[model samples]
Target chain A: MMDAWDDYSEKVMDHYENPRNVGIVEKANGTGVVGNPACGDVMKLTIRVENDIIVDAKFKTFGCGAAIATSSMVTEMVKGKSLADALEISNRGVMEALGGLPKVKRHCSVLAEEALKAAIADYEKNRRDISPAA
Target chain B: MNLIYMDHHATTPLDAEVLAAMMPALTSEYGNPSSNTHAYGHAARYMVDSARAQVAQLVGAPRPDDIIFTSGATEADNLALKGIAHAKDYMPARNIVTLAIEHKAVLDAARRLQKENVEIRFAAIDPYGVVDLDDLAAKIDKNTILISIQTANSEIGTIQPIREIGVIAKKHGVPFHTDAVQALGRYEIDVMRDHIDMLSISAHKMYGPKGIGALYVRRGLKLTPIIDGGGHERNMRSGTLNVPGIVGLGKAAEIAKRDLKSESERLLKLRNRLEDGILRRIEHVRINGHPTNRLPNNLNVAFAYVEGESLILACRGVALSSGSACTSTSLQSSYVLKAINVPDFLAHGSLRFGLGKSNSEEHVDIVLDLLEKGVRRLREMSPLYDMAKEGVSIESAHFSRHARGK
Candidate 1:
């Protein structure tokens, strides 16, 4: 009988209802996908990087409300940040930024964090390939 | 906010007539039924007896005395499973046969009996969540004390062939018990014709008050008391009677019996409309439960690439339930869906819509619109959906294997 929205914070619900930077980031740079369909959560993150700084970040996520909210929050947190700074954004940071999720939903934040880190890792790998002496 | 109550399988609002019937017990008619010395006691006893007869009539029990009131269906189910299994006469037969998709009330109690060295065999369910009668009969043997199966599943709404299962139990001379909480008023259940030894039902599921249910024990069936107290209800269950709840249950039963035929047809139509609309509007959806033999009021569906909880939340004005792992505290999807061989990814997206007396064509249309929009929006944000659109095989994706080893 509990309302499905009762456990969510306003900020979480806000991001879930109006996600930031949704969809793939054009044809440039790196894409990181984490989680999986079987567990009911999969997050795909894409970043458009320029001069080692993430200028654009977007996400495509298949998950619960918390998962979507966390994905949205993490993308906003990484936008305009350097690759190193974006990598420092942890799962706890995403949760805190969204005013914390339910205890059971904390894993969703972890997925967001993982997706962001993987995207940065992908960008670094692509950069290394492009200029070997950089 | 007028939220559509589509989660009737969880519980129902109390009927007006049931509340009216219960008001007397809650107010001035509050006297102990056992205290036979006073006029107040006589009045209380008369009301209790009448309510008992009403409940007995609803289920077609031969005698009013056959019904033993309990706290709710959970207690009734526990008593039917444990009380019968632990009975001195049946102790020698230490095995029980039940379906894999029974409610936790029956399954958990059977599990506890397992710790006491009682062998429990779970009969398999087919893709539509129907019990395989052949598998059930094969599991029953000379050592089987009881064959317990649900009349209908709450999650998927698949109505079992209870009469056939009864015949199987009778052939093997095993006591047949059914947790009929979901099917009590929705389907025609006659204990005599079905050869049912015990059946559990709850009032709340039938639009009565909560905290009142009964276990119908066939004449001459012996069951050990689970709650040993003042030797009430023929010494099988002991406690002070919940007079108000009992009156509510009795009135609810009477109303259900009177309207069962018409209400079922109405619900079936609304359910079909909802089902048909969702199928027409949504893409890559799969319906759960038996297509024909399911409860008239239940419709469960799995929307691929969209998680169940997210959809339920997105359709905010409608009340619903999900079989997804994210909805449960344990993070495990519905065992009933799992037993029916629904893939893990699909199971995570399963939603149960339980239509009730309040649902109408307008409500169904509203729900369909909300669902279409919700599924579309959620799928838009889905990575798997994108992959599927691009011709990637989601089944071979094996998404769980890459769950960071969680």
Candidate 2:
């Protein structure tokens, strides 16, 4: 029988145990929230973008180990990347960066991707509202 | 790091004395109890009979012959429900009344009977998981053949009023069956006093070997056999007796009966310490199940902002179980919790702490420290906690609908 911890990869455990950038980005231009408490997982992603480049990223998540790890990994992956490159980061990309997640935990990675998209969308909306003719 | 096991409701480590008693049966007493013509057979039969008496004594049965050994509680549950349902004497009665929060053993067996044209009526339970006696009595009719309820719940540890339910069943003239798997060693159960017609119990839950259990049937009660063969177990169950496991179970039962009072008091103290520490040290935690009418060893709590699996993983050395969707294969929270109308969020955050004989005050302290750190850490990362702190109404957040769609 598989022990509960056996389902997680070493990378997943490492990230879960030592999550990086685990707070909201101060004065962030964009913020995204996905998932909900009812499903037992939720994620909030915040980003600081300057000159169309992602300068800082942080997250707060309520979820299982996979959700926390994927949130941590997504934030790390998006930092220092251009907005276009960050937009291209998929759930599979987050999963791969952490070696691999159990099949059931794959959805947690999707939450990470959606939170990123929502954050970027928020940033774009803020820019559009600030200057309609940009 | 030494692992502290608080999941005793799942199973317990075999007792030293039980193992010592089982050694002779496992090594030299290798004989079929049915082979009455040989010395080996006589020895095995003697052990089996002694084990049966021990089990009978533990449950306050009138006779040892009333105990029918089986593989485990699941098998015994199946036999009880199916055997009584298929009995020619009660075939005309088609309804089996049971509680909605019963273990899957009884519920699934009842479901199987449903397919065979037998009606299965589930009675309602209170928020604390106690059966509503009035509702249960209302569900039973003239055609009801059996009323199955559990001695106690595994997830929340709510002890039912079994004797009252038994009296109701007796008044209705329907056979009462209880899955006493979780209550065997923790509580005193007398089949005669409780008015129970049949009861299922397992050994592993009481520090005995696995794959051994028994069903206590009231004297003079008639039921059709679920398994048919050489008419072992009074023609009710037929199989070669498991000599070693039986010996272990008997020894375990003896130990349990000897230590029942003192052990329960000790476990109750540990459970209270753990529960009190969590309630005092943690924020937004809700205790589940009955406050006073619960099992001495069980403490279930739901931390407001943290997911159960995350909390479990964060507390690495403490072995526990959760009623969270994340911990289950079907991605659904505990049905027992749901049956009691615990909200989805709280249900997802629920964790069960089943204290056992091996636990000590030092162990409880360590677990408390771990739980405090884990819940605090997880809450720090939880967006839900942030919203709650900011005075946002969680029920109005509208993210729950999106979660359900997944």
Candidate 3:
């Protein structure tokens, strides 16, 4: 029924409609993609690292309203924070910032956290590989 | 903005004529049909009789007395299946067979019967959501006491090859039952001609009031009473008659019979226009059900790279269901779609649009426009869409497993 929308918070709906930072970060230091096809949602997180701090964060997510909204919220939460602070962005925090997601869609929040951590891991991998050359 | 309702498969708005027909029963004509000696009771009895006749006419039942009113299709289905299952409890036939895509009423009833030691066999459905005739034939052996299938699936709107199924059941000397809840008003049905021995239908699906349904059993069929009470509905079902709901159902049935021929054509025209417009506008979309044999009032499509929930929420001012009514609330992708071999990702993106008599070409256009924009907006933000655009296969990308603690 149309009332199914009531299950989602207004903030969640907003990010789904007008999601911020929706494209890939070209020539990025690291990109993290997390999600199984079985889950019906996959998230890709991109980060620009400068002086050990995330200067910009962007995401492209293929998923439900909660998944997309959570991805957008995670991007907004991590920008202007150090890698450690960004890593501290928990799934519960992302859900809280978006008001809340339904019980069934709470995994979208977990996907957001997992994707962010995966991106940071990729950045560290890049740093480890390039520091020897520098 | 006024929302345009397109999810008629879930339920419909009560028609004005049905409301008018039901109003007297609810108020001034409020009398127990059982107390037939009194004037008030006589009036109520007459209304109930007329309603029974009207509904019988709608389904071409040989006798109105064969119709037993229940709470809804769920109850009707439970009564038809469980009643027959328990009635033949001592017989050698200990198994029942039904389609994988049947409504929860039949499925759950059969499941309960299974728990009580009745072997339940679920016939597989083809990728198009049609019950595989070969699989069905193999499942219905001499031990299979009853075979139940839906005339039209509520989720995908795929109409079954019911006549052939009925003939098979007849050939095997088994009683064939169909959950015709979705097909009652949309298609013409004749119990005898179709070889259907028992059938179920609900009122709300046909623009009648909710909480009222009927089960039609062929004459001379032996059945045990499910709801035992004061001997109402020929002792098969016993309860106070729902006079208002029955009246509304009768009026709806009468109107449906009169309008079905022309209404189906109109709905077909509207549905095709909606489907064609969305297909032309959207980039990676697939219609879920049978292209030609689907219900005229139904359109189900899966939009690539768009999540089912987000797409529905994004398309404001148009009412739709991401899945069928029964399973829509669950986060799980549609089981019907899964049974039909729709990939999990595409299954999650599917939406069902059920056009009703209330819809028009203008409404169709508006819905198509909204759907196109909504899918685009969501896909734009989708990483999977991005990968898909770059010729990446999403299924191949996610073969790795994850280990996360924080």
Candidate 4:
């Protein structure tokens, strides 16, 4: 039988092998973590959101190659975008960037998008709490 | 890359001797066994009868007539469950009792039977994947018609207590069936001694040709035919015989019987060496399945920080399965490991190695080396693994509460 990696595109395999932006951003302005412990894939995304634009983004994910690659791709996708634009970046965009994941690994792409939104949401929550604009 | 096949539970390479036995059938011996009135037919009939006797002997059944040929174990399983459930004599006892971890063939058949208003009861298994005897005892009542459990799980390789379960079935007077597709060639099974009323075996699983199998039904038991046709195989199964495949199955069975004891011993030693090597080399790794009751040729281990899919993908040089091939398409890890209450990380990270005739000490060592390297590489990329090594409980780690229903 053919290996499961055969279903993946060369780009997905490349991103998985040499994942970019790996590690934590401690004391970051906004941090998002998503995934179910029961499901065996988890993601923690840290972002430096300054003046409504994402200045820097980094990720640490625990999942299959697709999830890790998607997270890495998501970090790159949102690096220079506004929070609204980052939020607009869909899971499909991440999957497309990676060429594609297998049918079974498509769910990992969703994890990438969710982790980003969660980080942005965390930023909004932290901002609202600190600001008198509430 | 030269791939070393470690996935014997999926299927095995055809034995050379079995191929030799099947050559005549595949070549010049093309006579129809049903044409018994002439020499051409008589010769075919002779080959069929001899093959039938070999199959019966392998399973320790008294009468050769007790076996019915089918396409494969899937068909055999379907016939056993559906044939018996549809039997006029068994309608009053309308319940089917089987384990949760049975192959999809048995489980799917039971689902179909349930749709026909047959009550299907799934017996629970313990943490080690052994059927709970107490749960089974409570489930099998007078209304339970058939009790089906696998002799050995195809994924975890945990062998069930079939003899004890068979004794219970006998006490309740319910017919017992076992999907012995994985156990027959690897272990010894005697239908009479085990009180098995019916058993399922497939040729491809035993180093025989594919597309052939047999269902052993205790004599004097009547079955409602699933395939109604030329009334072949004493009306139990109907259709033209797969003469070549049958000959291969027969030869495979004969060889299995002859080599079972010695081969199992060798496999056991090799399996232990491979398993021990992995345990010694890696941290946070565990051996899955029963400690003593597992198949001699099977080794399942859970690598703490890696997903099985990723591991198999990287170690393409060693052919392996994360679970059964049937369910590998799904991403939910393994239901067998889940049913046994193994943690999700460990369960998702498990690999099943089915050592067979082709595997040797060299192959085992290479696989172990590949596994150690692969697990280490994958763990380096896993952040949850980072937390684990630092003694931080993953369950206690704070996670953002994004709505996950989508």
Candidate 5:
């Protein structure tokens, strides 16, 4: 593409311009960090849960607009969904949520999905570690 | 409306004196510098020689005869690499050493050479873009034909210790070439004192015309010409001398030499104010490159959670570039940033702000304000920010329960 961002939808631009979720969450059920040294992007996701419902979601991303926006959109998509449903949230779904991404920015959506999955896995493992002999 | 031109590192406006000097060559001096038979040819030849002297003086070279004009830095770089490599056709061993953060003019040249079974060794770099001198020293061996590095980086504006690198190369009996396109008038350089074998410079970088440049060759260095023709440029390059360009280059160099020190100081002050303002107003912003060994007018910063391209687009009226300018062609980001170990996340969010003679304190203030507002707005729409505010780490919420955004 002549311009990498020219292909982004309005929703993608919106999320990129006004990202929904950003910052950090401490001492939570799970946390995940993803970094791509090639592109110089880093992402850290944290989540809180209460009885199978995510209470809150936050992220700290050191990436471009697409990466940040994708993270924000992913958090919004998974906020109230069950862990199983969130895990099923593919990168495609995140891209769809933002109306689609430029081919170059495809990695941004992938990173968002990976971060979410990583965080969910962390939460599941934590629950298993603290379970009362279920 | 005054259009503040702070992107001098990108390209400088042609100096008026240079334009005046070039007019006669363009209008009446039509004979080729190589054509020794006519007045036109003699005049063009003299202009070319005068231009060469001007360029040599700016770089502290001993004589004008040591310089060879080229299309620009890119061509000069290619000639330095391929010309030297091809010259060693009689030798069996072929190896090259260069830093990871070199401009594509060098890096891509190395890459192309590698395709021909040449062994390429890249020196590691610190986050500040300094070549690991020890690592470079260790990589040197008998077969090491050339050590290529740049004087100053265009992206982060990091200045490499070319003199030190030259000494190391000499110790190993290797030829040293530096692409000083970004360093020509901005920094003090002496080809002989620094022990540099070959140096490339472009006119546009120093307020001369574009598509005109020169390469400095030490008195005794031997290399074949990459371009073939009527034996111009002392049989090193073949094209007829660009008389108008040469005259323009000479005038520009004279002007740059006269005003360089004061202009640099002014640019430094403006850059400092801009940097200080951004650091104070923004959260999670980091400056890239070494504080002390960088260009006075260049500033690179990482704004967390914001994309460099987006920021540039939002600030469309600002007329600044994002990192290396060359990497704008690819989604892969800047090779300079990658080589310096800038994390992909931060690299993607990197912004390159180069100041020029046209920029003033007022321009800096405007840029600072626009940047602050732009980043804040982008952060607000981020879902990650919302989740963090709610005291939830995405990892914990991922496995047990998913709360789809309401």
Candidate 6:
């Protein structure tokens, strides 16, 4: 009955329907939150790193369907990957993961990529602060 | 199953009688109304004239020739604003005064004129979108040539005191043009009686076919033509007459005029039921426009802390507009709400439900139930609600705090 699901690849639909790592991580070592008051779409990303790897990543997005799906895809892509590899995850990569979004909804995926980059940047800043010699 | 349609402010279904009246024009009797010396033209002209009479009767115009046909309200608006702006006597120094809450057709036209060195002044509206009469009066000067205001706002459904505003424009000896697109046929409008110099009306708004509209230019008011062509619409707008569309419009006007009283009463009851049902069932909801001074078929409410898009998605069975149908495609906040000082948080959560010919008590009940459920669910997950419950005002949260440089 929901044949429209076929437009999306199996992987994209899986992430959209059963999103992974969905929610906020409280008082985390690294957090990135981006908000667009205009469209009322907001994204908050939290990361926990052990060694040089992204040990855990999670996200919460308050937006339309594309936005929520994009954030979910971001979390799934970043998981089990090194912090540098996760930081390299691009908006174009997210779009490719989800087939594609309507032109108007492309902003949603772009926001997810920005949120992930911000989180990685925050983690690097924290590491630099902790290391007295730089 | 009983179906309900709440998009009356959008194009309405053609009345059966209107369709009957328009059949002849769409069938064999079609002819160019401008063509002379032919039986076809005579019949076509008769239908056109009859439709004009029907429209004139509804508006209480003293004569039928005062009405000029164009495409719908958007075209009418463009013609009135640009026509007046380009009149040879029109001075660039003369500012155009209009309210902030006007339809974009008018607002964007004014913006275009401003680019051509026409000074445009936007009068402020109160939080409820009612133009401040004092602020409007203060903005008028000898250099002000024209003022355009919508008779009723399409978004909030708030009715401006156009008659009062018309009096003010007359006092200042400036021409007043109203975008009566939303108010025509629903309300009584007479160019002379209302002291209006020019008015814009759309056919599709009152169950007429799309691509047909009319503008009321008071007789003897000389304005330059916006469309340069074969001297159509008394040279104000030049284009081939859309005979079929005009026939639909005329038939719609006739039916709307005949049924105005009873239909208005019925719409008011349905609208009130919808408003009361939702308010009684839902918490933290506020009506957007003035209660008494609004369209009988409109009920706009701000569902505090609930995302409007989510609520719409949840209630997919009923098709209704959030704000302007145009802006809904874009995920941006409603400019009308932002203009009237609806805080960003509440503005994003606002919903517009326009009642029309098809809504009923049962439909209202269904909507109310769905809305109650939708609002409760969405608000439960909203962080804004959590902040509000903790006694943190959104304004204080913004103005009192700045992110510490980390």
Report clashes for each candidate as comma-separated counts: 0, 0, 2, 0, 46, 1
DockQ of each: 0.65, 0.60, 0.49, 0.42, 0.16, 0.20
Q: In candidate 1, which residue ranges exceed 4 Å CA deviation? A: B89-93, B398-406
Off by over 4 Å in 2: A1-3, B88-93, B400-405
lDDT of 5 by residue, B23-97 (tens): 999897777887789887888888888888988898888989988888888989998998888888677778899
lDDT of each: 0.90, 0.91, 0.86, 0.86, 0.78, 0.76
Predicted candidate 4 versus true structure: per-residue lDDT over B1-406, tens digit per residue: 5779999999999999999999999998989999978887778888988999999999998998998999999999999999988884445558999988899999999999887889989888887789998899899887888999999999888999989999999998989999999998788999999999999989999899999999999997778888989999989999999999988888988998889899989999999999889979988888888988999999889888777767776676788888422225654568778788788767777889999999999998898888888888878777779888889887677666532342
Residue range B65-174, candidate 1, lDDT tens digits: 99999999999999988887788444565898998899999999999999888899988778997888888988988888899999999999999999999999999989
Q: DockQ: which candidate is best?
A: 1
DockQ category of candidate 2: medium
DockQ of 6: 0.20
lDDT of 2 at B164: 97
Top candidate, metric lDDT:
2
DockQ of 3: 0.49
Fnat, one value per model = 0.71, 0.63, 0.51, 0.42, 0.23, 0.11
Query: lDDT tens string, model 6, B65-133?
Result: 878898888888888888888883446386889988888899998899888788889888888788888
User: DockQ rank, highest first?
Assistant: 1, 2, 3, 4, 6, 5
Candidate 3 structure quality by residue, lDDT tens digits, B1-406 = 5888889999999999999999999999999999978999999999999999999999989899988888889999999888888889887658888877889899899989888789989888877888888999999877888999999999889999999999999999999999999987788888988999999989999999999999998888777888898989988899999999999989999999999999999999999999999888888999998888889999899888777877877777778888521225555678788888888878778899999989999999888888888887788787777778799897677533432221
lDDT of 4 by residue, A48-86 (tens): 988999988999876676777898899999998999899
Shift in Å, residue B338, candidate 5:
1.5
Clashing pairs in 1: none
In terms of lDDT, the poorest run of 10 residues in model 5 chain B is B397-406
Question: What lDDT score goes with residue B210 in model 3?
Answer: 96
| Candidate 2 lDDT tens digits, B26-90 | 99889999999999999999999999999999999999999999999999999999998888444
After superposing candidate 3 on the true structure, give the runs of residues whose Cα lies further than 4 Å from its correct spot.
Answer: A1-5, B324-327, B399-406
